[model samples]
Target: MTSGKPISSHLLPLDPRRRRSLAWAAGLALLFPLAW
Candidate 1:
């Protein structure tokens, strides 16, 4: 379980990349409403 903790911590940096992608996707979703 201790070894797994480090691996999980390494994945924390990946969260930001995922968040940026999600933000872009959400922005695109909002743009459709404006266009309509």
Candidate 2:
């Protein structure tokens, strides 16, 4: 296995929950553009 792939995969998971968190962040950024 590639060492880089193992390390990067740990950092960013392949799951639906991750997308939900990303969307939550975008919503927060839109609501508080200056704070983000």
Candidate 3:
């Protein structure tokens, strides 16, 4: 499994802005389903 995808690539940047945006998107997505 050593040849598999490297998770470090995704977590390398550690950008707070992108993370906050992603968190907002995720929160909205989760709340959207409840609206119906």
Candidate 4:
């Protein structure tokens, strides 16, 4: 079996999509506070 370090390193390639979704979710959360 592979080591845990290699498994965590593989997740590094997901940065772009993850960052974009995170920004979008943050924006929606901010809008919610204004709407209330």
Top model by lDDT, which number?
1
TM-score of 3: 0.59
TM-score of each: 0.52, 0.48, 0.59, 0.53
Task: Give a tens-digit lDDT track for model 4, residues 1-36.
Answer: 765467446656778788567658868988999999
Residue by residue across 1-36, what tens digits does model 3's lDDT show?
A: 642235335645778787678668878988999996
Please list all clashing residue pairs in model 2, or write none if there are none.
Answer: none
Inter-residue clash pairs, candidate 1:
none
Error of 3 at 9 (Å): 9.8
Best by TM-score: 3
Model 4: how far is 11 from its true place, Å? 11
Name every residue pair that clashes in candidate 3.
none
For candidate 1, lDDT tens digit of each residue in 1-36?
586477557656787887577668878988999999
| C-alpha RMSD of each candidate structure in angstroms | 9.4, 7.4, 5.7, 8.6
- Candidates in descending TM-score order: 3, 4, 1, 2
Displacement of residue 7 (Cα, Å) in model 3 is 8.1
Over 4 Å off, model 1: 1-14
Candidate 1, backbone clash total: 0
Q: Once model 4 is optimally superposed onto the true structure by TM-score, how far is the C-alpha of residue 3 displaced, in angstroms?
A: 31
